[model samples]
Target: MQANTVEQIAEVQRKYEELQQQFRAEAAEREAAAAAATREVEQRKKYDELQLQLQQMIQMF
Candidate 1:
């Protein structure tokens, strides 16, 4: 292949690798956000349950 053609191919390959890296990073960030949301929901549920139990105990006294 000609030198110019080879250079063009190399440039394309570099751009593709950069895009792949960005895609992976974005996917990781999304996964982390989803996990955090799940944790928050779980904590809220626990807090509500505790509050309910406290109210029940107070009524007994």
Candidate 2:
């Protein structure tokens, strides 16, 4: 009986570790996606600013 209990405990620990790994992977993916989105937004903002500057220069000409 003790051996069986030990096996059961080991199995549970293994499953817990797997779940923790899965969660960590998902979190990493989400962080990457957020970073990408932030970069895209910064790029867009820069492009918009450049466009406005160009428009102003054209008007001056």
Candidate 3:
């Protein structure tokens, strides 16, 4: 191939790699946020259960 054609191909390849990297990073961030939200929901559920138990114990007394 000609030199200019080769350079253009290389530039396109670089841009494609950069876009792939950005997409991967965005996916990782989304996964991390989802995991954090799941953990928070679990914690809230546990807290609610504990509160119910405490109220039941108080009622017994």
Give the TM-score of each candidate: 0.90, 0.98, 0.95
lDDT against true structure, model 2: 1.00
Question: 2 or 3: which has the higher lDDT?
Answer: 2
Instruction: Give per-residue CA lDDT, model 1, range 1-61, as digits (tens).
Output: 6999999999999999999999999999999999999999999999999999999999999
Model 3 per-residue lDDT at 28: 100
- Which residue runs does candidate 3 get wrong by more than 4 Å? none
lDDT of 2 by residue, 1-61 (tens): 9999999999999999999999999999999999999999999999999999999999999
- Residue 41 in model 2: lDDT: 100
lDDT tens digits, residues 1-61, model 3? Answer: 6999999999999999999999999999999999999999999999999999999999999
Q: Is candidate 1 or candidate 2 better by lDDT?
A: 2
lDDT score for candidate 3 against the true structure: 0.99
Candidate 2 stretches with Cα past 4 Å from truth are none
| lDDT of all predictions | 0.99, 1.00, 0.99
Q: Which residue segments of model 1 deviate by more than 4 Å?
A: none
